[model samples]
Target: MKKLITVFILSLLAFTAYSQQADRFRFQMDLGAAAPKGGGIGALVNFEPQILVQRNLALGLRFGVAGLAKDIVYYDIPKDFTGEISANTSFSGTANYYFNYKKGKAAPYVGAGFGYYTFSSVNIESTDIDPDDIGNLRASFAWAPMVRAGVELGKFRIGAEYNFVPKSDLQNIAGEVIGQSTNEYFGFTLGFFVGGGRWGRFQ
Candidate 1:
């Protein structure tokens, strides 16, 4: 949570630093639901600060956080787990190109980015006689690629994104692998932003 706050503050500071160039500065936020590829659902939120280098092209830094609840089943070890909550954070460089886009009108875009994903530690319990027999597990981070497509109409945005994150191993106190958790997910967003004057790129 502390890290999330720090990143948000940095985003605001970025806006302040670049606010001088109103025509080129853009700050947008998106909030909506997230569905894990492994089979679960939760919420997602993002803050992006951008610079419009060209009328139809913009580059930005995206900071996002996602949380989900999932269940993992291991056939080999005969492990059946439930209620595993995973939280992930990301910071990435994004480039978006608008098609027949205008500031106040509908702005349709396709985007791509590469980023680092940090997954939070999760607890995996043993379905044996006692659940506490197994110790707590620690989570590790991964570097993954992502893609997004969406549209921005006036100050509102609706988009969809996919994160191609790798599976993470759950390790116990002895550093032995107990199980694996799927980390990839899909996010749907509906949000609004402040900034970017009303204008159009193409005639």
Candidate 2:
């Protein structure tokens, strides 16, 4: 019985090493919609390159871009806003921890990241203002934090993330501070990856 157990343990260890080395790295592409806090719907795309650091941990760098339609709040004037748009681009370093239970095909993960975000000035045309009077709201770059959770089944990945971004001052073409707009958003994604050699914890 002791001899049999020893052989089984060795076999398991070999298999585990093989699994980890099969695909040490992978690339992922995700396309999804973003819902801004107190704003209209938008879309985003993310490109990530990931390296497996351990059996249950991976590290990645994400390049992402998104457009959101959020409101602008004026400090002096009581404004009734109508249409709005803001463009955002970001680059972040991320780490994911996976939970693949007992060779199960599905791997669930939670992760966190911090990135630099660039925002284009939001343009909002109030129904009360003149049509040609619309000025591009000036914006600035910010450093933000992100949190995400997801499940990966084979090559396909489904995930959701929230970006905590700082609010920026809305300035007109004259460079006068007019109001503020929240740059935070929630994103949902459905995409697939090219590596990581089958997502089971032990198989």
Candidate 3:
């Protein structure tokens, strides 16, 4: 998390130094799919609220969640042990800093940040275990890196982004299980912007 903050500060300084050359503030909304590097479907939708403080720089908060699910009737593990696994979802939020570059109406941007995600609804079944044996898993808080790009048309904008959340073991149903790692992701977005007078804010 500290590392993520350090990067954001450096990017903010760089954008501030070059933002005086542009006009107008920028905003955006985005949706996309997230796939787990180890397991789970890479499906998701994201709505990001952003403010372009400078022509070359912007800062915003990403408020949304990512989910992964699959249905299994049987399993083959170290033993013949198996039952049924249903679905799971992960939620995340973070502060994002973007460095934007542009010419005329086209703008491309990239960003990175850190956030926390909660993993829930991970269920496994076995004939030896009762239905009441199922329980919720604890949440994991970790550092994540994200990247995004977009285009500006008038007061409206369209873009997409991919957020990568690394795997970390903060808590688990089995009391801190190890060797279980996964990733979370976000795909595309659509958004709008207002204010900042005539100084290209989203430039």
Q: What are the models' TM-scores?
A: 0.85, 0.82, 0.56
Weakest ten-residue segment in model 3 by summed lDDT: 79-88
Best by the TM-score measure: 1
- Candidate 1 clashing pairs, residues 3+ apart or interchain: none
In candidate 3, position 51 carries an lDDT of 49
Q: Please report, in order, the local distance difference test score of every candidate based on alpha carbons.
A: 0.77, 0.76, 0.46
Candidate 2: C-alpha lDDT: 0.76
Give per-residue CA lDDT, model 1, range 94-189, as digits (tens).
888887534357888899888778877776555552445446766678888889999887778899999898888777668877778888889999
lDDT by residue (1-203, candidate 3, tens digit) is 34434554564455445445445233344545555443446455544434455455556555455555432221223322221122222223333333334334444455655454445434444565454533443435555666666665655657666667665432335664422334445455565665432224332
Candidate 2 segments exceeding 4 Å error: 1-22, 131-134, 201-203
Q: Could you give candidate 2's per-residue lDDT for residues 1-203 as a string of tens digits?
A: 24333543564455345445567777788989998888778899887777777777877777788888766686656863643654477878789998875577788999999988887756666656653554776777789999999998888999999999988877777888877877789999999998773765442
Model 1 residue 139 lDDT score: 66
Q: What residue runs in model 3 are displaced by over 4 Å at the alpha carbon?
A: 1-26, 70-76, 79-103, 125-134, 155-160, 168-181, 190-203
